[model samples]
Target: MMYDQLKVLEKTIIDIKKKYQLVNDELNSLKQKPNTDPKELAALKTQLSNYRNEHDSAKKQLGDLDKRYQNLAEAHHMIGEEQDKLHKQLADLQRKNSELQQHNDQLKQQNHDIKQQNHDLQEKNQLAAERTQVVLKRLTRIDQMEG
Candidate 1:
């Protein structure tokens, strides 16, 4: 976009320069014309004045355009800075999300280990209870036999 605007400004400047050059050539040609009538000279002077006015106007317009281009350049720079900041923010967010994912995986592994330990403890408790029950039955049979 900036390039496009610059091109337009360059073209405008070129056109103005061409117009000024043409006016200058015309004025030079009028000066060279020998023994020119007073009325003709006066007319030429009027034409010269008109050309000067046009040149001045073009110069003023060019100045205005230059100011506008400067403003646009500043705006473009600011937008570029904002884009860089946003890109950095996105990168930081991605890094943070990756860290969180790694933490989640670690927590999942710990949960799995705890569940296995709980299962092993439950099996051990069940085996101990079965052994105690079998011993109590044998003692009760022996006591009945003695009685």
Candidate 2:
């Protein structure tokens, strides 16, 4: 699960970098293009300004995603430690000469809850990835048309 999140985060970072570069290159090309139509030039400039804003937004999101990646890594490490502790506790409980049904059930429930949370996180991450891909595709289409 953490690995999937890492992949998604890395992909997002790459996409944002690509977008930034594409926008910068387009702006440079606009600068080099011969001045023939003032109206068209103004429109292109407006479009470039919007892309610049979007590029800045993507850059900010990339930074935020990096922080989230770090947070997820830390959470995974903590979850591992917690699982280890729970396993040890379960072992000790099993060694006791008493009914262990209730304790075992509680542990099982905790495990189930953790699994559910991880599943939900994975789904959300996947949805976010889908949305990012759609946006990237749209941007590529626009770039192609403009070029």
Candidate 3:
């Protein structure tokens, strides 16, 4: 987009330059022409004055356009820098996501191991309860004989 604007500005500058040169040449030609009639000379002077005014106006416009073009170029450069920063941010986020995924996988494996350990503890508790029950029954029988 900036390139296109610059191209258009360059073309406008070229056109304005051509017009200025043409006006200058015309004024010079009028100066060289041999004049007899005062009225004709006055008319030529008026025409030259008009041409000079037009040239001055064109020059002012060209200056304004040049300033605008410079501003646009600066804006374009800033936009490019911003784009580069955003691209870097995107890349960093992607890398962080990858690391998080790896961490999540590790946590999942740990969870599975903890569940297996819980199951083993439950089985051990059941066996201990059965042994206690058997010992109680044997003690009750012994107590009755003693009574």
- Which of the numbered candidates is closest to the native, going by highest TM-score? 1
Cα lDDT, all candidates: 0.91, 0.90, 0.93
lDDT of 3 by residue, 35-80 (tens): 9999998898899889888988998999999999989989999999
How far is 101's C-alpha from truth in model 2 (Å)? 21
**Per-residue lDDT of 1-147 in model 1, one digit per residue for the tens?**
887998898898889889989998988887788845889878888988999899899999989998988988899899999999999999999999999999999999999999999999999999999998999999999999999
Q: After superposition, how far is residue 69 of candidate 3 from its true place, in Å?
A: 0.7
lDDT of the structure predicted as candidate 3 = 0.93
Q: Would you list the rank order by TM-score, best first? A: 1, 3, 2
Runs of candidate 3 with Cα error greater than 4 angstroms are: 1-3, 134-147
> Which regions of candidate 1 deviate over 4 angstroms?
139-147
Error of 3 at 131 (Å): 4.2
* Sequence-dependent TM-score of model 3: 0.80
Clashes per model (N, Cα, C within 3 A) = 0, 0, 0
